[model samples]
Target chain A: MATDLMSNGNRPSAEDIAARRKVIEVDRLDFAFGARQVLFDISLDVREGEIMVVMGGSGSGKTTLLRHLVGLMPPQPGKVKLLDKDMGALNRRQLLDLKRRIGVAFQFGALFSSLTVAENVKLPLRELTDLEERTMDIMANMKLEVCNLSGFGHLMPADLSGGMMKRASIARAIVMDPKLVFLDEPSSGLDPAVSSALDDLILKLRDAMDISVVVVSHDIESAFKIADRITILDKGRILISDRVDAVRNSPNERVQNLLHRRSEQIDVDPTEYLRRLAGD
Target chain B: MANPAKFFEQIGRRTASGLDEMGYATVLFFEAIYWTLTGWRQRQPVRIAATFAAMVEIGVAALPIATLLAATIGLMLAIQSLYSLGIFGAEQYAFIGIALSVVREFSPMIMGILIAGRSGSAIAARLATMNINQEIDALQVMGINPNRFLVAPVLIALVVMMPCLAMWANIVSILAAGLYVSAELNQSFGAYLNDTLDVLKVDDVWHGLGKAGLFGIIIALVGVVNGSMVKGGAEGVGRVTTRSVVLSVTLIVVADMIFAYLTTR
Candidate 1:
């Protein structure tokens, strides 16, 4: 009865996307690339001023789902409303306006290798605003400082370590102090320590800036450690979308297998198997 | 008990998505055009110097070699055509025929091919390197247009260089063809110059120059677009670099043929 009830509620309520001015609300999204469906009926919400981590295995539509949220890729089969506007329905002027309110740290850090860190930080400010040199510099310094990268402004992104580079990218993303920030695989190539430091920086940014944060990552430890809430996906369906602790303790076999790497999933434990067979 | 209405709604949503991507692609192309022009302010000196240097490299500096090739080809073709005409006792019209045909047809086509091979390859390689290094994405994330930053200078530079190159090729071919006829065929230099002048008009040369300018843009745009999209490891960059030159050349030839048909007719 509970399963039937849950399935019946899959349809988004009339007020679901239209209600609150959520930072992001994905309503029953179904996405496919021709015959290969990547996401199926994914319904979720990213509230204002909260850190929501969308975690899943590789090829589980983590990045694809994030792209839809950021307006880089339009939502398919349902609406992805960001800040109360459907991303798919925005006009050119409105889209630009909407994009200005968000920041994205792409999977690769996406820093312009040609420009120095200072110039990279200077980009959004220069293009979108009329701030004077000193003001822009001040803002750039503040963002860099937030990322713990103040003195190294003039250095190229190539000069930074993997962790530092990601921080710099994060700094660039938030230079606009956007209402929403999206990060795709923030800890992909970094060491554990560096990854933890990045998590600390993310938490610091969320609290300090008071902005909604959505991170798309496949790293299990990093996800569990930093995610306030975890949305686990398998085969394009949401296996679990709840608090990290609740999802951790859930009884769903698929969710359990994903979260707790299913030791009994294989043949038997070596010692137990040996003892039982030997006794026989 | 089934949401059959939901199924058709899904199809409509997919259709809308395809249209949105098409719209974004169009927007990106124009943004690239606008950005290339304004991106100059981002890195003023180096960007300006690099573009100016590309113009000099492609236009003024390559003039001598380009002229030599055009002239040599003109001489060989003129000689061969005159020999064939001489069999029908139309040998005396060699200067008129060669001057018109070479200046109007071959000059622009050769210039297009040369620019596509040299400048196009250089552009593709540079864009590929920029892409590999993440500079293009950097510009985009920064809200600065990479097209404005990278493509604009090359596009502007190519449009300027191509006409000048074609003119240089025209002059060189005419001079070499004149010398060849004067020394070997015992045709007077003054006679060769006058006959050629009578057959070739300002419009013919201008039309050919116009084609060269358009062809330059085609080649440069092709190089930049292909190069900017290069991804993965070194092999990916190499593959796109090769594709840039090949595609540019192919487009140039096809464009030239169409332009030639239109103008000559």
Candidate 2:
């Protein structure tokens, strides 16, 4: 298993290390929405064929960071390099071409409501490839099977359960066989068994297709289970980024607190609280 | 003094925002046109399919309403003109007046307004929903040009279909008016047809069709622009869709006035 080989430091073996290269490089990424700063000088690297789980609490800027990585939001006061090309520097055409190699599965599936599941899965192929209709259909079904939704492609997005929707979205995301896949909260809003099965599917995808996977999730158990490396974000800053074992054994107070599900409490002054309540 | 200053400030802000929206719409219009022409040259399947679907929605599906409105308006116009013209002993001239009005003005203007309300609002709502659902972002992430995929097809369909709808409306309206003149007004059907044919020039037909085409372009632009600019979520989509209908109707009227003035001169 891939995890067995990386159990030491979660680093690829020397023989495998030579074959892997950085696919995504984020340097000094600082983002702000109007007056509120969201991401603060964050940096990270994703290797060619690894599952990197980005975990954060609500409002921790995990989704914002994912958006920046996928070029949905531009890098301001920072740099992001994808496939060795600077995202900030790419023209519209170049950026579009780059997007063809990257697949993003949004949290809510984001499938076209007017199109059936088979149509939704075949959309990328229809738009980007010259494949025959039969070939596209076959390919879409193959992907649906991989996501454990083989026969469900005939249904519409509204007809599917939450877990089914997520799986269908994953199927659509992988239909094009993209070099990089970004799954946003794939296991979110799902039962433990379904989520675990999804985690296994993610692992199988990375191992079989040799594609890099960047998953933004708050599901700690799933993150710990599937990630070769885990990056924890808190309050718009990265708390820790290390191998799964290293993260598990880390001595950092905040990291330990997070792993143990401990919440922090802040003492409030009575006068200040009263003043705020009085609309001062 | 402060109140007056605030009023002027508000006016200035509104003007600036309106101009900004117009500028954005203009850019979108040109981009949609560019993509459509390029895609046609390249024989892009997605653009072709979208164009066909839009044509069915904007043209074929809208025919019944367009015809109904035209026929009712034509009957009303003939009745009103006959009542007034009868006082002057010029009731025989009602055919000429109705023909000229329906062919050069009412059919195209009413058709444009109806389509702006029906198809334009629908386009805005559909695109706005897609915007709120993150489907627009999904399209962008998949290397698909949203404008080429969404707007260009509708624009092409509207431009092609609006004039045809107007022409159909003109024909139905004239026929309905002729029926009233012959049956209710006690005028001979042959004489009424002759009077209408004598006054209705080819130029009148072209002018109405031209105005309809321009109004179609306006409706498409306003719908797409408002939809693409939608922020927030479901509430935003609702707001923009309503605004698109109101703005499209206003723009169509404005364009009609401009065309009327220029063509007359």
Q: In model 1, which runs have C-alpha deviations exceeding 4 angstroms?
A: A1-21, A132-135, A261-280, B1-98, B122-154, B172-199, B224-233
The segments of candidate 2 whose C-alpha lies over 4 angstroms from its true place after superposition are A1-19, A265-280, B1-9, B40-46
lDDT of 2 at A92: 78
Reference-based lDDT, each prediction: 0.77, 0.88
Cα RMSD for candidate 1? 9.5
- Candidate 1 lDDT over A29-68, as tens digits, reads 9999999999999999877666677877668888788867
| Cα RMSD for candidates in order | 9.5, 3.6
Q: Where's the lowest-lDDT run of ten residues in candidate 2 chain A? A: A2-11
User: TM-score of chain A for candidate 2?
Assistant: 0.89
For candidate 1, write residues B6-51 as lDDT tens digits.
Answer: 9889989979964764464455456656556544443321256657
Q: Estimate, for each residue in B13-103, the C-alpha lDDT of model 2 and write its tens digit.
A: 9999999999998998888878866754433433677788899999899988998999999999989989989999888888888998898
Residue-wise C-alpha lDDT for candidate 2, range A1-280, written one tens digit per residue = 4453243233354346336788999999999999999999999988898788998888999999999999989999999999898999999778977998999999989999999999999999988778999999999999999888988988989999988898888888888898999999999899988887888888888877889999999887887777878999999999999877789889998888887687674346778878988999
